[model samples]
Target: MLFKREFKRNLRSLIIWSIIIAGIILLYLSIFPSMAKEQANMDNLMNAVPSGMQKAFGMDRLSLGTLLGFYGIEIHLMTTLLGSIFAALLASGIVAKEQNEKTAEFLLALPISRQTIIAQKGAAVAANVALFNLVIVAASLIGFQFSSAQTLSYKAFFLLELAVFMMHLTFAAVAFLFSAVARRTRSIVSMSLGLVFIMYFLSVVAGISDKLSWLKYVSPFKYADAAQILTEQSFRPLYAVVMAVVIIGCFFAAYGYYRNKDIVV
Candidate 1:
């Protein structure tokens, strides 16, 4: 019953997200292909770009003319950021809303077992994520259809998005765990956003500094490297396994915490 209600709420919220996100995708596909044309024909684009700009944007190995390179290096950041923001909002709200609405006690009054509650809520979150991923995949395929002078494989980009999708799942887990424990909805939402950006910054720092390279393993961003997924056609399977474990561990831990706690009236 708890999961069903939560899913209903979330599914309604997703409608707005879908409309806004579709607009963003259409915007990206419209402009970038045109800009990419100029960059492709110009050999000096790389040379004229400042070193700081190249390093800051990680444009060293990618060419604007190539759809794979341009998308991974330039266009995908917006998509990635939007995805993280959506996951954070969905996850942070999922558990916290129960307490915020003063519904926790009523929810607990139902005969449903705590474990089933956790399982179903997790399923609800997972379903939400899967739906958005389908959107991204659909948008990518549609975008590819309209591009000319660009030889690109939709399968390759979709695989990169898959790595990103997994990391977003882990992000949702982190946010859901925080929401379960937090005293207030505002704190849960803010901390969830902080966690997402912190991990991304850590990954960027690790990319720049050899001394801090080990920090990359501590972030979900490592498993979703746009360049690596686009160029190598590979993402770290071991890291994906670790992220899956962490996500499961978080939800189970949340269930343990939820079961033992007494809800305040």
Candidate 2:
């Protein structure tokens, strides 16, 4: 019942986010043909771009001529950015909103346990994230069908999608922890978004200079690198393990904190 309630409560948000992600995928992918037509000129233009900027944007690692390359270079970052925001928004509000709205007391008076509440809300957030990514994947495949570029390796593309989903999961878990422990919900979304952008910038900066490359270790974006996935055609098991640890650790922390938190309402 709790799971169903949470899922239903977030159904509208799920639909809206799915549309936004799918639309972005379609819009960006529609331009691939035009870009591919002027591939030589585009390559030359990219070549003239500063090395730091190229690395920061991953332009240095991908060829613009191929569909998969173009998607990796142009669309992957945007997907990850938007997906992270969506995950954060969902997670930051799920539990904190009840407290902020003074309804947590009413809910707490019921027979339900805090752990069950967290588990149900976590399931809802996970389901929404999964749906959002599934929609994007479908939209991307449809967009690819419309383009004249050569076929992409399904394995590489699926791996990239998995990486993106894992990145979203990481952000969601962090945001969930914040929501569980926060005294007030007013700044949860802002804080989560800020952290995400900070991590993203760290990854970009690390890419621009070898001296700062160590920063990538702290950035979830680095673990989901589309360029590496495209080039290697494989996911990094070590990074996957790290991401899983972070997710599980944050969730457990949230559960522990929330279980002992006092409800003021």
Candidate 3:
């Protein structure tokens, strides 16, 4: 019952985010043909760009003229950012809202344990993230169909999406941990967004110089890098394992914290 309620409560927001992300994908992809028309000029312009800038933006690894390459270089970052925000916002609010709204007492009066509550809420958040990614995948396929460039390997595309989903799951788990431990809900979004952007910046910095390359190990975006996925047509199994470990660790930590937390009315 709690799972159903949480799912219904978040359904509207999930739909809205899905629409916004899909729209962004469509908008950028629609421009691909026009961009491809000036591919030579754009290539020249990009070649003239500083090598560091090219590396930072993935312009050095992908051809902006090709459909898959264009998507990797242009659309991937937007989708990843927006998706992370959506996951963080949802995960951060799921548990903290009850405390912030002074409804935890009423919820605790229910027959369910806190563990069940967290599990249900976490499942809802995961379902929403999965749904959002599914929509984006469909939107991307449609966009590719309409564009003039030839379609790349669908296997590679799906692998890229899987990596992105893993990254989103990690962020959601982190937000869930924050929500479980937070005394107040007011700063949840701010904190989550700050963390996401910080990691993103670190990933970009890591790409710009070898000295900072170690930063990639800490950034989820590095594991989900579309440029690398596009170039290799596959993702590193080790990175995926690391992401899974992070997700499991965060989730267990959240459950442990929330289970022992005092519900102050």
Best by lDDT: 3
lDDT of each: 0.76, 0.89, 0.90
Residue-level lDDT of model 2, residues 32-55, one tens digit each, is: 888898999989998999999888
Q: Per-residue error at 182 for model 1, in Å?
A: 2.0
User: Stretches of candidate 1 above 4 Å error?
Assistant: 40-43, 46-56
User: Could you tell me the TM-score of candidate 3?
Assistant: 0.97
| Candidate number with the higher TM-score (2 or 3) | 3
Candidate numbers, best lDDT first, in rank order: 3, 2, 1
Instruction: Compose the digit string of candidate 1's lDDT tens values, residues 105-211.
Output: 78777898877776788788888887887787787667765676678766678778888788778888888888777768999999999988998888877777768
Better of 1 and 2 by lDDT: 2
- By lDDT, the better pick of 2 and 3 is 3
Q: In TM-score terms, which candidate is top?
A: 3
CA deviation > 4 Å runs, candidate 2: none
TM-score of each: 0.90, 0.96, 0.97
* Candidates sorted on TM-score, descending: 3, 2, 1
Backbone collisions counted per model: 0, 0, 0
Clashing pairs in 2: none
How many backbone collisions does model 2 have? 0
